[model samples]
Target chain A: MTVELASIEGQRPDGQEREQDLSKSPLSIRGLTVTYGEKPAVFSVDMTVQPGQMTAIIGPNGAGKSTMLKAALGIVPPVSGRVQVFGRPLEEQRARIAYVPQRASVDWDFPTRVIDVVLMGLYRELGLLSRIRGEHKARAQECLERVGMADFAERQIGQLSGGQQQRVFLARALAQGADLYLLDEPFAGVDAATEKAIISVLKSLRAAGKTVVVVHHDLATVAEYFDNVFLINTRRVAEGPVAEAFTEATLQAAYGGRLATTQVSQLAHKA
Target chain B: MSGEEFVPLSLTPLLIGVFAAVACALPGNFLLLRRQALIGDAISHVVLPGIVVAFLISGAISAGPMMLGAAGAAVVAVVLIEAIRRLGRIEPGAAMGVVFTTMFAGGVLLLEQTDTSTVHLDVEHALYGNLESLIWLDAIGWSSLLDAEALSNLPVELPRMALTLVGVCLFIAVFWRALKISTFDEGFARTMGIRTNALGLGLVITAAVAAVAAFDAVGSIIVIAMFICPPAAARMMTNRLEAQIGWSVGFAVIAAVVGYVLAGYGPLWLGQQDAVSAAGMIATISGLILALAAVFGPCRSRAGAPAGV
Candidate 1:
């Protein structure tokens, strides 16, 4: 089916547009509670991510950071919640949102080239039985070049290194041409150079007025990399401007006693 | 006698086998790529009861009733497997095992309840097809194409299989993009608004139709080998989907031809009087080709390719 391409921020002077503009947020989640069988993964949480900013969902292991992201995207059904993107339901605004799942979630050895993966980003727009035109191919190539992966566009995905593979995934996300991007662990295992490249790309996205939410774990660079932080430990611990919300107390609360040892290691590395 | 004397005798049966093999291989590629190869085997076995039940209800073997029964059985097989997997929280392979074994056993019991001996529908024929006996006993040579009598005498299985293969190829051609995207990455395809679940169901139903068509000529057991072997061997030869499909059809046709020739004439060359079972020989040839591809394929890692990959 052809995705009905419409403005993420509705253009008509209607009551709906007025309500959406009042929120002024790209994503709004209310009472998002997710449970797995007898245990609750995420307690009742309310979060609103502003437009045109880099928001980091930071938490320690088993803190439900990724689970929260999935719940917001409607990938995993929340026990009870509502997620609105651009004041519309997530199902209605999915075309305007790009989602990059964890690198481990996909089969890298699939018999497809890098260009094919990038082209998949456009499949929603192309619809069924339609040939991907030269313009689409050129756009895909442009996206690949943006991530410094144009040279590897024709290569099989499995042939790439770990860092290069992540770049290809980024290129695929870029090809979506979405105003909002949700990425999961973009720097989990990359080298410093790859990490720098990814951060620069994320910054460029913000400069272009695109909302980018990343699930991050490295506490050392959170202050430097993010404009806003949502520290979560099953429930929302602290959230706001990174300088104000990302305090030592918040980190200690989210990570428990582990934060002391992490601070010592951070200091030792600096020395 | 000249070698040309044997051409007309073997031509129709050989063509039928080739058509059935090629038809199975087309949808078989997707089944292999999707790692549902056992489902292909499952559909083939389950359709046996479908065909028998159709005969029982209709009190005769006809195309419409038989196809309806087979297609219904195929859908039931898929649904049951899914239900068991979801309810029992078991491995998909185990679920498939439970559903298909019960359906096949049900078919055997159904056969026992009735007299299938009067009709062409017997357990032995369904298991091992009587391919050698399907000779076009008409007046003459290859030049008899001008006579209506020769054409009329041609076996019914040949044309039916030919049409089935054509329909399968057309379906694949129409849905090539959807099939590729869904088989490679289903979750992403769904997020793209591709209706991936419907596409996946369409594929399984198409596979069932192709299996049922092939079953009439090649029998049920060998359909499994035809469904998995050539596609698997083709996967070893190429990493591109289009090239893989082409290689699969080529391999399937070659197996049909080589296997038929071996079964029909190899005994004569060995100083024996009668021919061997063509279905068994074709299945054996498919296995050999798969083994060969595993040993010396372009992709060296294809020896034990994981289903998830």
Candidate 2:
């Protein structure tokens, strides 16, 4: 039913590459609807992220923010949607993208070194028997140092602080050498220093013309951290520049009664 | 234990026990980390029907056909467990319990109905293997280890288990990074374009191969024990995966040797008339090792109240 409307921006091109220019938006989704059993998670959600922009996907908890991102990435099955990256299907541009998942999604007790976690970013080039060569280690080390975690290379991953763990994940994404980065709650449950370090790394990525999209929670940090905001609550609400789309009306619409009036107003005024 | 006396009777079973334990323990490390340790128990339990069906089909107790049967059974059990879990909407542990137990029961009943007057295929043999009987009658002494003819007469289970261990080791070595990543964080592995589902299936299948091979040699008792106890105990010892695997292999070898010697001679030392089952003792020893590690291993606790918290 929404296919006709989604056709306005063009259908998600089949797996084949389109002749469109490479300057197309880094990510674009049309008519995306996802459901788990009978309950809909995201419905008819359409979002587009322009190149070189820092965008935040914000919604109240359980508003399908993560699901929408996952569906767009083909991590989760979407009922009806087309997702494209750089004017081509996502699979085609995988080498140019890096994804930093949430900190809590993995078992922290896994027996691995901090450096090895960062080296996974270079997995694209690894072969069955290919050893982790000197160059790969150097790159991983550089990424770690970039995140200010240079001294904890040999430590067990389980022994690290949550903020340190999050830095390791970012370091991994940095090691990917990706043109586009997608992060899920990179700032959640981290110390202030960790938050500042992550934001700066992302800002550097933005300055280098790499598109970055984050699934964010803190409304207060929205205007400071991201250049654009995509507010979604089960469906697309408002999206655009932080100063324009992030208003009291949009915050109310996205948060609904779940957020107190004062909190929304405070966030809107803060933005 | 003199070499002349030990060469023919105890050598083959001891070597087979060690090989089987190490083979299962290698893959067991990843399974333990993945929290799929029960898959080993599941695979070991389900091996009974596989072996029984193979014996019935071939009308013999040969290794090849019995192995094939066991492999087929393991696959069936995995698929059925998955199906029940999905269709019935039950938890995975419950689904595994249901499928493995039902298949194991069916196997026990099948063993009862079959005619076994001439062969050694019985419920007791399947449950607790005849390890003492797998002797090297042709081995005259330690020199027999160097003799080609004597070597040829060695128990087939030895070579088979050695090959299985190598295969498991190779699989782990080749896919070590992927396994570690997928086991720790499946979503991130998938996002990195690794086929997590296929890799997971590959891992389960590898575990099944180890379980089936070890089950054939030493029975399901040791299979279940080796698949969990050694790796779990090793987990308490080290926080490094490389070190953990090293510790697991060491523990497995120790359990096999110590358990076999005790089973063979502990009875005489205690003034008993008969020897105990080497399989039972080996399992018990591994369990004891796990208990000890749980109490005193350096990394026994969960990494200092989890700094991440």
Candidate 3:
């Protein structure tokens, strides 16, 4: 089903005001090449994520969208590239960047509670071995409430549904108090209601002037959900405003022959 | 033995067992949580070669030389495991199996060359241990603790195990937050400047030390059992890290006390005169406790706990 594009800044009407500011973009990757053993996952990809916007990195399966994000977060060491957050190297600007790995990356059955996971966001703020005072607990509860998980704070993480798990992760990112959030496949396996909630949260994040870069797969809602779209296969194909840059031609280039069938089905359904 | 004579003998072994149990189980929780429980088993096996080699070089069976050798062997064992994991491209479990078995075999071969006829250095002592033999007989009564001569006769194992447990408690206390965060999520902890690699390496080293410290009193089997079982059982009881650790230590101490008494009296209960090996009994009790927890503990349904979150 088509999603509502009314709230999304699909094309910047005040284009002059949104001029490319390399120093101000929340995230910028230059010549980022990530290799897995002998094979390259992402090759010399260069992209910038503007602040105060929701950017979607979209492509087919095995398109290195997650790899690019992992490289930028330093989870996977880039073979050759530099990642900058707010015009500084990732290491220098680490405090301002928050990353949410794939929901499947962590063990859901780990012996930990919902509050413990959220409190991890405050590890840097609390420092080592210091007691988590009431103020810190209050902040974590506030973040959990933002994602509608305040009621489930005491539940074991494994008890949560996939959508609830996604919300918990989003709450954790909110607790991080970072200027930029990088989410990898957050919408995967989530219910429609969770998707709406997540989008609303993303909209709020943008409203608060925080940047969010999400690795998304559903091409139908890319324009509707995000202000900017970055299209890639192994290499970056195109990137900019969704209306201008996310064309059928670019989708075909990113997905090869797979896009043509999907386009035809959409056209058939529309007719 | 009369009840009067049983007092001092039981107290010393009981204390030693408690110390060993507490020491091993403290770090055991972290090891189990980190999905490196086998490393405790590996370190225990690998330290045998170190202790044997140190005996050959120092030509003495003193604690200092033995500790040095055990520490050296434990470090080398970890390095070899990592080397095999990275260079040999082997999975961690297989690599641990390869290094520990080989090093332990080498230790056995070396032990054959050295004279192990002495009670303290006997090969049997390495496996079964001699908790019953650790009696402070000279300390005739509680007042003997005030007598320097009587106190001097106390088994070194008692003090050594006690000190190790104290040290482990302090280490876990001081680094609680770092350990919890790093164990929960290493990559994110790294991004938060946790020095995750150093914290992880430090944890492995601490486990090695605990295994080595408990090695002489409880033997490797008991050390391995204490390392895995109490923590595994405790994990089945609670989801909070602090509570899990507390439960693990509590379970460990309980197992130690009950196991020591059972080792001494279980045969009597069976209408036999001979007591069982205290180390074997301790390990067996730990297994029983684990089974009980798995069946009836609050979090038993989530027992698998899934390695590497």
Candidate 4:
């Protein structure tokens, strides 16, 4: 599997011109460091997400996986770093990107309907006056259909189950119609049906040539879910196709002694 | 109440109270749903110091300088609260508690030390504003409604409050979607280029302007009450933002009109001589409305939770 990964990576022409005049990685971060107080939260980490690929960033607890993602998007200010999307500054290219944050980051009990939550994705086009015509509602409804949440459009958000909430968030991301999708823990705490629904939607997104980067756990699903993987603790561990980068050595380095030997052995044997 | 008497004594103050209630309640809906209801409380408390400082600097009770001073104090309080929360690594609730309490106490001290006796400024007046005294001096009867001279002689608070309401309405109308989106999910709002931080500050500032304007006409008590009670009661009645806003405005109008009338006439009917404080009565009525909604509103309980919240 590892050899196959290396060969597939080698086969890429490496400059497909992508959506830009010059081919560039969809996301590129260099020497990024973020700090909360005295101690650094995420060190001088670097990562590159190639265009039109499903990539995963994996690490142990408190490994700053979420922080790194946040820094790339400027959600949390980085102490020292530079990030680019499609080879330009993030701010300039923000409209071309979509983000799905963790469910816990928001107040679920907020007064809104599911359709309204999805409609927020079109805020850029709607602008100040937002004389929302039927077309915007139709678009939101279509996004909800993509995530199998069409029937839940009129439902109050607070009444949703955890899995249903996750689907609604995915539907919102889909409504953005963006070229690049960055999701933080889209699968955490979701049920199996939701997991399958999310993956299928993500696969369709990739099939349509959109770039996807997810901060993922559940190592058992990594081989099946992602083609590209980046392992990190405070800094980059290894990054490449999952078959090549999802090695025992990289896992051990990322998780340290905190990872059990049997778990590592099972993952190795599973691969 | 005869039209001859009511037109002169009650019309202007009633309009001021209603305007004040609606203005504060409009933003209160968002703040309450965002779990930032206490921001209104904090802003109202800090406005006292702003008023006192305005008087000290300009040595006048004019509206413009007082409004500016109140706005300045509100900004300072917001900055101080954020500084304490970030620098001290303290939770927001505690930081807000510290800042607002200390600022309010300082305002009381300043009020005592300063010779504000010549003006209508005092701690008691600040808490329970002289809502009753804001009467139309030139109003004669129903004809006054159409008489430009009578209208010109209307209390200054009437127009000032109307303008404040218009400002609040315009802000909400222009930024409705952004405010709704950011209040729900700030991260997603940021990702969408919504300027969540600026919008958050803008929201607080809007609340501050409403608080300062309302505080001048009604008092801190009604400002605080209108900020929390109307929106909270409205929250109990619905799950939709539009519906919640509508209900809140309705509730505010009810509290203002009903509370003012009850304060003015209920005692008269009970064989009493003077009316009670309109500010305190409005606050009390709004609280009562909140209590009734809490117990009986259909959407009051947490979704899928047992019996009571």
What tens-digit string does per-residue lDDT give for candidate 1 at B1-309? Answer: 332455457777888889888889999998888888877788878888999999999988667788999988877888999999999999988998898899998987898789888777878778767677666777367676677977887878777888888998988998888888778776566556667777888888778878887787778756888999999999888767778899899999999989999998889999999988898889889989999998998864632233565
In terms of lDDT, the best-performing candidate is 4
TM-score each candidate.
0.86, 0.92, 0.89, 0.93
* Per-model DockQ: 0.31, 0.53, 0.34, 0.56
Q: Which stretches in model 4 have alpha-carbon errors above 4 Å?
A: A1-22, B75-95, B304-309
Candidate 2 lDDT, B88-159, residue by residue in tens: 999988998898899999998998998865676787777667788889999888999999999999988889
**3 or 4: which has the higher DockQ?**
4
**What does candidate 2's lDDT look like per residue over A165-261, in tens digits?**
9999999999999878999999999999999999999999999989999999999899888899999999999999998899999999998888889
lDDT of 1 by residue, A152-210 (tens): 88887777777887888889889999878998999988778778888999999999988
Collision pairs in model 4: none
Task: Please give, for residues B1-309, the per-residue lDDT of candidate 4 as tens digits.
Answer: 788999999999999999999999999988887788988888888778889999999998778998898888877887998999999999988988898899999999999999999877899989998899999989999899999999999999899999999999999999998999999998888887889899988887888888988888898999999999999999999999999999999999999999999999989999999999999999999999999999999888677332464
Best by DockQ: 4
Which numbered prediction scores highest in TM-score against the true structure?
Answer: 4
In model 2, how large is the Cα lDDT of residue B24? 92
Report the interface RMSD that candidate 2 achieves against the true structure, in angstroms.
1.6
Question: Quality of candidate 3's docking, in CAPRI categories?
Answer: acceptable
Off by over 4 Å in 3: A1-23, A261-271, B1-7, B74-92, B146-149, B303-309
Rank list by DockQ: 4, 2, 3, 1
Candidate achieving higher DockQ, 1 or 4: 4
